[model samples]
Target chain A: MLELSRRRFLIGVGLSGLAVASPRLMAAGSSAGEQTFHSRPIPSTGESVPAIGMGTWITFNVGGDQYLIDERTRVLETFLERNGTVIDCSPMYGSAADVIGAGLDKLGAHDRIFAATKIWTSDGSETREQAATSERRWGIDRFDLLQVHNLLAWQEHLVTLKEMKAEGRVRYLGITTSHGRRHRELARIMETEPLDFVQLTYNVLDREAEERLLPLARERGIAVIVNRPFQGGSLFRRFQSEPLPSWAPEAGVGNWAEFFLKFIISHPAVTCAIPATTRVEHMQENMGAMYGQLPDTSQRRMMADYVRQL
Target chain B: MSGATWLSYSLQDFVMFGPEVFLRLFARINQDLWPWLLLWPLAGLVLPWFGRQAAELPRRLAMALAGLAWIGCGYLFLVRYYGPVNWPATRFGWAFVVQGLFLLILKGRALPGPMAWPVAVSWWLAVLLLPWLSVLEMPDLWAIALFGLAPGVTVAATVLLFAGQPSPLRWLLLMLPLVWSLFSAATYWALGTFWLMGFPVATLVLLVVALRFNPSPAQNPGSQSVHRGPGRQSP
Candidate 1:
């Protein structure tokens, strides 16, 4: 049976190659032994998303050059190897969604991906069109999660999204906002909308979300996706010439990036924190944030105090 | 006279180039003329309004020439200050390059928009203070008191200068240069340059000049206009 499964895998690889002619498939199959997978439960659905999701906002904005495509394919492979299924993209992040789609195709991870994207336009028609475009771009009949980006045109999109959810075209309907600018609005929507998930910026430095949005999400039974876990590179800057705080080890954070991210994910409300990275090493570091001992409430306060001191 | 004398002579030859040698070194260092390149428009727009007409021509000409010469000088200084393949410098250089490219593509200009001034200033401060603040246990006491104070001073000066009709945005904008200068000072320290001591003097001069030559014109009826004190329009 083991031999049979191995042969099936080989056949899957052969078919995948014949179907897509992707070198990524060849590499992925060849390096299966080297890959590691990690998983976390989706708060709403109980389905696991590989803890290390790919962020295509800034890194995947490299358009469609072959180099970028190859790098993206590797990134996808890395994520998949680590049991990561979430690929967060947005229509608002330049050409990232399109690039991610192409990378997904090249990596043959389209079906494997827990595909996530946003509808940013205001008009209902335009929102619908954008959703359709995302579907076409990703070459998928159904999306794992379709979010309203920054609450823009969300009211109009939510109705259609609900309809789509009922139609089984979208597995989840959600909303997201970055920058912590609209937490009050997000909380209101979480209360009003039947949201499965909600994404927003939350990190140690910016604890404003914790004041209300986090608890609200927990109460609403919405899975919380943390964005800008590194505070858009500000946290890293704070650690530039400084040694990692000694207490970081107590919380099981090895590096400053992981330290910041782990603090965010440690919150009970946080399902996942999608920290973007351009380097595979950084991807690995970010993924590590998902594992290990998380800071408790006391430790989180300690971390906050430490950051303030810096 | 002695073996030590011969070694010292060789070392001096390598390190301290004679006056003629220093001139050539400066020429090589100044090849790209980046400092001068950046200084030209600053002088052209700023100096004349300062009532320093005699200084203007010489300063402008010197800046233009320096801009031309510093390309090489700047390269040499960079090579000396940061060893070959310095990651941080390389990163900053690439950032500038990409920014220049982006500006070119978007606005058909190499320089950023005026709104970018605040951002630039903020970046400069961050660059200077971040490194120090990172390692220091008491950043407020040491780093903030020393370097961080500049932004406060600049902000206060802007508020005072703008007085009753001040736009908060303009006051915020002044903080940029202060922050940036702090960052540069920090960078110099990180690079182990004794010459960084001269930075405060340069910063003071720039601050005074910047305050002296206000961007707002007198005839402009904008509320944010910088009018000369008592009744006359501010230069």
Candidate 2:
């Protein structure tokens, strides 16, 4: 009986080890293979962004304690190693910009970052001050993209951004809104304002952007950044039990999150889709969506129908 | 100072002539749901904190309040901004139902053990169905039932399965706020704005504090190690 129990224990340990190691092994195998970049042209400049961008909204705000600080540093290192260029954060995100600054400093990756951030305050003076503070925090001389976040103080900030752009303090000036709330205003802004980019929500679950914002962006030659491809956590929750649809393979989506994200980026207007992830594994999966064929118009419709059916 | 004055004046004027401002804003816009969307994370951050003091009761009240707030906000926005469009009443109702189930499952006496599949299943079904129906336009009830509800329920179920006797899933489920922090970040990032970024950072700090200040394992019945099946025990 003792011997039998000992054998059982050994077998259990072996099985558990295998279960844990299998994923790591698969990951290693995948990484060992060749790496590639999937490029999309910026509508305004016709320059290409590497499709995948790192969002630092929650993940970058790692401060207060030592352990969290350490974890955040690791996350930053992982992000840089993954070839992610676009680092999106804002002053409204509670030290996110500051933390990311520190992370970039630690990783020595500041120059590598495609720094994208927003001015959230409504007052023009505050907007200018915040924009300056963001620059100081990130330790950058010029911002790649300075966006008016959620249309909050958009007009006030737009004038400031235009001035900054003219003075060479910012490379691009744009406005962003998520949640399909201000597409019409966004459209007007797109029409009148000489915006280089427009960021908004676009996911399989929330495709309201498709009806107008996307076409407007395309027509106006504004680069599009898709936010909320997962609908916060709603998409993840929805796909938890459901197997990846068979059609996912055709679109090069290895997981459900990618399936949703790839669908958004597949749009011609989308220069990049920023999907924030805390876990390294999730970031890797999201990056995979950047690779492979994005659905063409017909494929996008088909994909949309498939997701709707699910 | 003059800039601040002008800003306040502009906002006050905008508020005073709300109808005109709405018309002007919506003239070219297809729909304006931005203000309504801001309430989601605002409710998420505020409700949990307000309910923190009352423990389970406060949580339940907050959930109900949030549900009501969402419905009311949606209605007000539709009426004020969208102008009596064909809004989906059933979807809004389902959102409240899901929120109710979520609160029930979360606030119940001593977190239900893994055996509480009913609560998990129901909560999952509601969230999946609410969003799928309202947001995604998915029509299949079974797909909503299976996919939407399954992941979170499974996470809870896994926690419950590992939880030892006398310790319900609640203690382990406290890790949920950490997970929620992740989701909140993802949501904000996906939404492409920096709002709600503070909540996750605050939650993370709170979690760290709770971990530090909370009583040691000897004092808590739920601290016992969970046993796996057939001679297996967690390390």
Candidate 3:
């Protein structure tokens, strides 16, 4: 199987999105032996997304700069090379959706891509128009997920999203909040409303989500997409001077990137962790966390405590 | 940096460009235009007129100009210009366009009645503060604090100069710049440039003041000012 995957990776599907088989990804393992890519179900439809995904906050917001766009294309290629899906973007992130679309078009990787973006307006009319604009920007017919950014006018947009879902314009509907801004309001909405997913900030340092939001998601069967898994790059700045914990390889955690990511996805309710990156090597490192052995519950606590000590 | 050095580097290294880059970009956009010197001053003149008099024309004209400001920031600054250099400007361009339209149809007094001293102070501060930006010791190209174009200045002026009650339409118009001010504050901090933190702070302060001085419905229902947008005749 590994041999076949090597052939497929070398010459696969013309870089077609999902079908670009990457079984060879399992061959190159962390401290652990060979392992396959891990995926979690999107609780609503039971369809699985890769445990790792890409985010386009500041990283992909390079507007109209062709040089940067080409550089980002290299990053996307590396991501696909490592078998990534679920590229998350928002109109609020400047020209990210456009840049991502441009990169995917360059690579002919659209077929395998599972794209997601947000409807970020306060009114229903704007929401409808922005969603359409997002569709055009991403160069995709229907989004896998359409989130209400920061719950701005969520009440009005929710009605429109539901209708869009019914009309086959969007595959799933969810809402996002970040910076730990509105968890209580988010919780009430999760309990009262039916949604496929909820995107929020959750990391080793910011474990507040574990208190209610994560468990609520588990109970409500809502897949959680974790953002700011690096706390907007705060994690690296904090730990870059320190060496990786000597025993990190015990859980297949090779480096800080994998360590931070493994801790995020190890949570039972997490569907994926979308960490943005502009460099190909960083993309490779981020994707490496996907094949590793995730820490068990007690081990997760240990990882958290270890980081807290630092 | 060597290849290994680069690979090991973190996100701080990847953010690309410095604070001066952004400020210079804005300055380049404002290049050699003396006519624009009067833009904000004139808007300042029109902004407070929403409240002092009963004539709807001044308020309408201000709202129309406010629309132009939104579209100016959206199209002239954000899309046609800034977007080519920055990604946020593209989406923000859409925001400006939407806000400009919202203002075009907006109905209300700029203030419910006589301008509050706080509002007046805030407006004067927005204009007077321009020269003081020299104290910021920023690069000449980076000295952009014009209304309608910059984020925080836009927010302060929007709230301070708003005519009347917070209708759904008015709030819709206010939402983007309010959000943009916060984003701008954080971005400036990251870029290590002007603290620019005051935009969001001033916006909140003005909002609190406006809510307090707001007129009761009995005082100004704004029924006459609120009319359907163009081509839709009143019954």
Point to the candidate with the largest TM-score: 3
The C-alpha TM-scores of every prediction are: 0.52, 0.52, 0.60
- Model 2, which residues run further than 4 Å from truth? A1-36, B1-235
Docking category of candidate 2: incorrect
Tell me the TM-score of chain B in each candidate: 0.32, 0.30, 0.75
The candidate with the higher TM-score, 2 or 3, is 3
Question: lDDT tens digits, residues A1-310, model 3?
Answer: 1122322343334333333355533322122443646677788876666789999887876665566789999999998878787889987776788888899889987766667888887676787789889988887766778999988889998988999888777778999988676789999999999999899999999988999999999999999999999987879999978987777877678889999999998888899999998889999989988885777777788898898899
- Each model's Cα RMSD: 17.7, 23.4, 12.4
DockQ of 1: 0.02
Write the residue-wise lDDT of candidate 1 on B1-235 in tens digits.
Answer: 2374345332212221112211222233234343453343233233222222222233233223222222222232322322121223333333323332332232211111121233234324433443233123222222221121122222222222222212453444334335545644554444334343344434554455444443433422343321212222332
True contacts kept of each: 0.00, 0.00, 0.23
Interface RMSD of 3: 8.2
DockQ of each two-chain model: 0.02, 0.02, 0.12
For model 1 chain A, give the 10-residue run with minimal summed lDDT: A28-37
Q: Candidate 3 chain B, which ten residues in sequence have the lowest lDDT sum?
A: B226-235
For residues B88-166, write the lDDT of model 2, one tens digit per residue. Answer: 3224334424443554444323221122223223333333332232122223322221111222222222222123213
Cα lDDT for residue A47, model 3?
63
Model 1's alpha-carbon lDDT is 0.54
